[model samples]
Target: MKKLPLKIVLLFTVLFASSNLFAQDFQGKAYYVSKTTMDMDEWGGRDMSPERKKQMMERMKSFLEKEYVLTFSQVESIYKEDEKLEAPGAGRGFRMGGSMTGGPKYKNVKTKEVIQDQEFFGKQFLIKDELKTIEWKMGTETKLIGQYTAFKATATVPVDRFDWRSMRRSNSDDEKKEKKKADKDSVKSTNTDITKSDDPLSEIEVPKTIDVVAWYTPQIPVNQGPDNYWGLPGLILEVNADRTTILCTKIVLNPSDKETIEQPKKGEVVTQAEYTEIITKKMQEMREMYGGRNRGRRGH
Candidate 1:
C-alpha cells in the first residue's frame, strides 16, 4: 500500500473545494423603482385649465410610479411588477396616451428564449419567441448609479408599429378615409403604370426606432436587467429608454432561501409577429365598429 505525499494531498483538497464553490449557482433578487414624468403639453394636458391640469397630474401620479422585482439565477430571470390595487377609474374607457410597460417577462439566456405575458383588450397572449438581439455600442463613459460604478452602453431598438396605443392614435377616421381614397386611386393608376409593384397600404411610414441607454455594473457580473434588456457585460442597474427610466434600488445576492423560476404557461401561445397581427386586426375591427355607431348617431 502507498500513500500520497503531503503536498499532493493538500493540492487535491484545495482543488476539490474550489470546484464545489464554483459549481454552486448564484441567485439574486433586484428591487427596481420606475418613475415616468409626463409631458402635460405633449398629451393635451396643457389645453386644460390650471386647476384641471393639477387634478390630472394628481390622478396620474399613482399610475406613473411603479415597482418591479427581478429574480435571477445564472442563466434565467423573471421580471414582474409588484401587485398593487388599481387606481380608481383605472378601468374606465381608453385614455389618449399612457405608459408602454408590458407584462410579466421571462428570459432564459442559456436557451435564448423569451416568454412574455401580454394582455390587450381583455385577451391574454403568451409571446413565446427568440429573444430580441441588440447591437449595443459600448462607450468609454462611466458613472455611478447608487453604490455600483456603471459603464454606459447605447442601442437602437425597433419600435413595433402595431403597438395598440400608437396604432389607435394614428388611425383616426379622417386619416383612414384619406388613406382609403388614396389607396383606391393608386390601385387604378397602377394599371397604367406597370412599374408599380408595392401596395400603398404597406408603404405607410411610422417611427421605426427607439434609443436605449443603459448603465451596467461589472461588480455584479450578471447579464440581466429589467424588462427585455440584457447582453451587457454586467448587471444593468439603470436604464433610460425614451421617457422611461428604471433604477435599481436594492440587490440581494445568494439568499438563504431559493425561489423557483418557472416559465409562465397560461395564455394563448403565439409568436411576437403573430401577436402583433392579432392585436392590429382586433383594433381595426374596434375602430370600424365605433365609427359605425357614431355614423348611426349622426343619422338619427
Candidate 2:
C-alpha cells in the first residue's frame, strides 16, 4: 500500500514536467481578415457621377480589404499584412501622397514594448515605443469563435495612434485654405499632378478617441491580437475599431514548424510622436516649395 503512494508521486512529477515543457514550446498563428468602410460624402465624392464614383471605389477597394497573420507566443507576437498580388487595375495609387502603410509590428507583452516598421517618402523608419496599457472593460457576454468560446471586451483609444482608416478632414481655416489651393491647382493640372498635391496631409484629421470592441478566447491562454492590440486574458479573435473590422479566420496552435519572432531592426529608430512630427515637417516643406514655385509662375 505504501508503494501505491510512491507510484502516485512519480505520476504527478511526470505531469508537472510535461506541463512545463508545453509552456516553454507553446506558440500559435492566427489568420485575420481586415476590412474598412470609407464614407464617400466625407471625402467630397458626393458630387461625382456614378461612373466616376464606381471607378474610385474600385481603386480604393484593395486598400480597404486586407488579410494579415499574427504569430504569437506567450510573451511576444508579430502582426503583419499577408502579401498578395494587387488586383487588376489596382495600381499603387495610394502611395502618391506618401505611403502610410506600415510593415511588420512586433510586440512584447512582458516588457510592454512595441516596434513597428514604416516607410515614408522612400525612407524606412523603425518606430519603437512603449506600449500604452489599455483599460479593457470585460463583459459577461460570450460567443463562439471557431472551436473556442470568446468573451467581449471594450476599450477607448486615442485616435492619433497610427490608424490610417480613421483619417478625416479637419475643420481648421488653415486646412480650408490648403484644400482650396489644391482644388484650384487640380483644375489646371492633370490627374497625376493632383495626386502629387503639396501638403496632402494638411487637412487630414483623426478623432480624439476611437471605441474598440474585441472578442477574445481564453482557450488560447495568450494575450495577443492583430495590429497594435494586446491585453486581456486570452488571444483576441476579432476587433472592431472605428471604420475598420479585423476578424480571425484560422488559428494554428503548436504547429510542427515555429516562426522566429524577431524585432525589426531596419530603419531610423524613432518614437511614435517623433515620427509624426517628422512627417508633419516634411509635408510643410513640400507645401512651401510648391507654393513658391506657383508664385514665381504667376510673377512671370
Candidate 3:
C-alpha cells in the first residue's frame, strides 16, 4: 500500500470499513496541529554517569549551538469538495513537549515534538478506537463525552510508508539500494530547482500534517468521514481528543448568494518535517564535534 496523503485521508475513511458501510453517510476532515509531548523515558536525558552526562552536555551544547527552536508551519492540503479554498482557516493544537518516555532500548533520542494533520467535523467524532472492538456481536459503551452518546470502536493501522526513514529500514537490502538510487536520481534532477534565495527560510520545505482532535454534533448525519476513520458512517467533528481542535466555532447552514465563507491563509509559520530534520542533523553534528573535542582533551 502507498503512503496516504495528508489531505487524501478520505480514501482511507472507507478503505478498511466493514460491509455495512452503505448504511453510514459522513465525511471526514483534516487539520494542521501544533502539539507537544514530553519525554518521560529514562534515556531522554543527558544525565547517566557524571562522565557520560558531562560528555552528553557538551554534545547538547554543540547541537543547540545552531540555535534550534520549534516554529509552526503549514503542511498537506484538505479538500472535501475536491476544490481548493484560499485558506481553510485555523484551529488549536495540543502541546506535547518533554512528556514522553524513552528507554535504553530506544536508541539515543531527544525531547521532540510531533503533530498530525487531521481533523473531523460533522455529526460525530471518534472518541476511542480499540483493537478488534468493531465485532458485530460485542463491544463496550460509555457516556464520558458529555451529553452525546458514545461507544467503543477499534481500528488497526497497517505498517506501510514511503518516507526516507521507512525506506532506509526496509527488510529488502536490494530494495534499500534501489530506493537510495531513486532518491539520488530525484535529488540530482531537482538540485537545480533549489533556487538560491536571499532568505534562509525560503529554502525550507514544510510537512503537511497537523495532529487535531475535533468535536461534532451527533444529531447530524452519520457517515465515517474523510480521512482514516470513515468506518463510523458519520461526519468526524473532532480528532486527537485533547491534542487539537476544529469545532464549528461557527457554521452557517444556509444564506443568500451574497453570503461567503472565505478560507483562512494566515498564522504561525513552520514545518514539522523540516524542523525535525534540522534538529536531527544539528544533533548528529554536535555529537561528532563534541566527541572529537573530548578525544583531543584525553590526548592532552
Candidate 4:
C-alpha cells in the first residue's frame, strides 16, 4: 500500500513538470467580447420620455460594448481592442468616462509587470505598473467553455475611483449635503450671486471594492487573460466584474504566424498613481468651469 501511494505521487509530479516544459514554448490567441451594462434609471433617466430613453440607450450602446484580442505566450501576453470604424459621434461616451478602456495592454506574468497605453483627453500616457495580484479562492465547480473544461474562481478587488462599471449616481442624501455646502460657500463669497459649481463628477460615487468571478481552463496552462486579469493556474476564459462581463468567443492555439509580443513605448511614461492624480485634478478643474458657467447663466 505504501509503495503504491509513493508511485502515484511520483507520477503526478512528473506530469506537472512535463506540463511546465510544454508551456514554456506555447503561444496562442484568444478573442473576447466585453460588455458593460448602464442603468439609465439609476442616472435619473426615469424622468425622460420612453422614446428619449430609447434613443439615449442606442447612442450609448457602442461605447459599452467592445471586442478584444489577447495574444499570449508562456509568460507574456498582449490584450488589445479589435478596431472597427464607428458612425459619427458613436464614441462620445469615451470622453465622459476617462480613458483606460480598450487600449493595448501588455503583461509579463514572470516579472509581475503591466504596461498599458492610455489616451486621456488627447494626451497619451504609458502606465507602467505592477501587475494586480488577486487572491483567488479556487472552487471545485466546473463547466465547459467551448472544448476546454473550466473551473470557477472568485476574488474581491479594490475598485478604482475612475472605474465606471462600479460607479453609481449620488442619492438624495448626498445631493442635500452638497446643496447645504454650496449654500454656505455662497454666503462667504463676495459676489452673492455665485453658488457652487456643477461638477460633472459630483453625482458619481464608486464603491471601495467589488467582487469578481472568473472561469479558467487548465488545458491551455498559461497564466494570461483579457485586460488586467491574470495570476491563475490557467488561462482565464471569462470574467464577471461589477457591471462588466468579458467572455472569450474563440481561441486559436499555435497559429502558423506567431507575432512577437512587445510593450507599448509611445506615450509619456507615468506610474499608475501619478496618472490617477492627473485625472483627478483635471476633473476638479472641469467642476470649477461648469460651476462658473452655471453662475453666469443664473446671473443673466
RMSD of each: 10.1, 8.9, 18.6, 4.1
For model 2, the stretches where C-alpha displacement exceeds 4 angstroms are 1-22, 96-98, 171-202, 293-300
What tens digits encode model 4's per-residue C-alpha lDDT throughout 99-206?
A: 444379999999999999988887888999999898999876778899977878999999989877788887688687887887677645657343543566766789
Clashes of each: 0, 0, 55, 1
Q: What are the Cα lDDT values of the candidates? A: 0.72, 0.81, 0.29, 0.83
What is the alpha-carbon lDDT of model 2 when measured against the actual structure? 0.81
In the range 173-200, model 2's lDDT, one tens digit per residue, is: 8766767877677556643332324544
Ranking by lDDT: 4, 2, 1, 3
Alpha carbon RMSD to native, model 2:
8.9
**Better by lDDT, candidate 4 or 3:** 4
Predicted structure 2, TM vs. truth: 0.80
Write down the worst ten-residue block by lDDT for model 1.
192-201
Ranking by TM-score: 4, 2, 1, 3
TM-score attained by model 3: 0.27
- Name model 1 segments beyond 4 Å from true: 1-24, 85-101, 162-206
